[model samples]
Target: MSGSESSAPAGQAAPEALSFTVHSMPQPSLADRRSRVLGGRLRLLLVLLACAAPVIASYFTYYVIRPDGRTNYGTLIQPSRGWPADLALQAIDGAAVAPAALRGQWLLVTVGDAACDASCEKHLYMQRQLREMLGRERDRVDRVWLITDGGTPAQALREAVEATGPVWMLRVDRAVLARWLAPADGQALGDHLYIVDPMGEWMMRMPADPTPQQVKRDLDRLLRASSSWDRAGRE
Candidate 1:
């Protein structure tokens, strides 16, 4: 082969190889690549932050703010606690129900048997009356009767309950009931009315004989406090 012929083949090969390499190994610009990485990191950070927000907010609200300044009517249960994991609860009509079902609405719960006494009746009356006093916001709260016994409720009791649309006659296991909402030294479960938040957490318990005015005040304060996060109903 001649010198010029060899040189031409070399030149042709060099350009062809260079073009092939350019097409084979495509690369993004520095700015575009950086932006993609940063965007992915930003999305991951946002997801982590979203998951942590509720715990952070609750700690901030409960610990940072001193309850000393606030005058609350209901005695805040010392060692504010929650229901047991295995809390056995049933429905009035013999169907099973869980504590989670109590979520999504404020619960005004009273523990008693179907054969209610004077105290039981009094608490029941208070529950209904207190809810009614909430006016337009009454529907946001539910009056729940945690009946420990399996005895069926009487027709008269049902009639009284029907008059109040927000009432629920629940049948919870007695042992589970005792585990939670523990009564005073001599008091029975039927004595006092307890307050449970919409989150299935038993937040507060009233005195054995909670006056209507006191309960109304407590309810008002709770409504005011939760107004920021909670709406009128579960939307």
Candidate 2:
């Protein structure tokens, strides 16, 4: 005991020593933790949406609400159909091509028997010319020949068609293909050329006998609209 404190406390009580009781910080409640998690999830979703905005906007502009009105020549398949997962596709060499491989490139698909009659030949010629017509944008488009019958194409016709860029020559079931793509009334399955986006969904179909220039115009619009998101090669 100090002398001052003892002397001062003769009649008065001594002062208590200064002291503190430590308390722990309050913990977060279950509800508060849940809210924090939800907030983090929402922020992640917003980031994803921001990344995909350009692609969504382009498709919306081209398909959903076209400001330029309906000047498109190709028949738009409303609610576009996806590439049939079960649809068996094979290369000319008899190697099976997985349906997933078709993704990541815009496809100009033409269907016909391997025999390739007059109308089929005409379509093939037009297909090549149209891609070429794209000029600098030609590499962005691929020419695909989906042979409906099991038979292989003639060497001469194959040589003629594949003279420039390589053509995706594949064999598929006629009946299976018919179920996926339909022609106009009174027209056969081989009448039209189908337009498939890079994601492998059939979006448009050309006329039974389409004008080259008009077809090119529709392609131009589609390519330009998707330019921001799409690239020239497969993934």
Candidate 3:
């Protein structure tokens, strides 16, 4: 009931400043801040590395421990070139063929006379057999027979090529064909099996008469090597 006693005077009501000592917050030096940031970044990097290790390890195991003794029947050409920009082609039906159409599949190409010489028959057989041996992956590889010299193949020769399996008997000009498929120093265009990759690049040239077994080995290794990225289909 005593307002004067309950309510202190304005001068007395003003609370005095507390006598507590002000302690400054400890400031981190630039080096300390950098160290913490570095530690956090290292931890994040370690997490990412852990996620990537299995895939990287799988590649390492396959490449390093799998005993890479596989060999190719084709002469392994170093630095093989892509299909020349100026290269021209003609299909068996005399229709103009574009080199760009060869992309998206492995091409096992052979050049030979339309007259079907003994050597040409052998190459054709090997090409068929090598492709057949690929099993499920056979469709991924195609056989392209470039009958050079512009000579029209006999009906029997065309029948024989068709009978072998899926073989393309394209009639290509010898001059243009030769420009695309350059033989070795002592070889001729019709003397070897030329390999063109999925990217339309002529990558390898096999011996004139490669054995079926030799060609098979080369294909197996190539398929295995490219399995991570390549698939069955045209470009």
Q: After superposition, which runs of candidate 3 have C-alpha atoms over 4 Å from their true positions?
A: 1-66, 69-72
Which lDDT tens digits does candidate 1 get at residues 174-217? 88777777766687777788888777667777888988998888
lDDT for each residue of candidate 2 in 1-235, tens digit (9 for 90 to 100): 5576456546777677899999999999999999999999999999999999988899898987886686789999988889665799999889998877878888998989899999999999999999999998898898989998779999999999998889999898877777678888888888998999888889999998899999999999999999999989887
Model 3 residue 57 lDDT?
A: 59
Clash number for each model: 0, 0, 1
Per-candidate Cα lDDT values, in order, are 0.76, 0.89, 0.76
User: Candidate 3's residue-wise lDDT over 1-235, tens digit each?
Assistant: 6576657677776556679888999999999999999999999999999876754554454445555554345666556578667777787777888887878888989888788788888888788888878999988888998877778888786777777465767777677666668887787788888888787778688776677788787778767766665678785
lDDT score, candidate 2, position 33: 100
Q: What's model 2's TM-score?
A: 0.85
Global local distance difference test of model 1: 0.76
Per-candidate TM-score against the hidden true structure: 0.74, 0.85, 0.68
Candidate 1 ranges with C-alpha deviation above 4 Å: 1-68
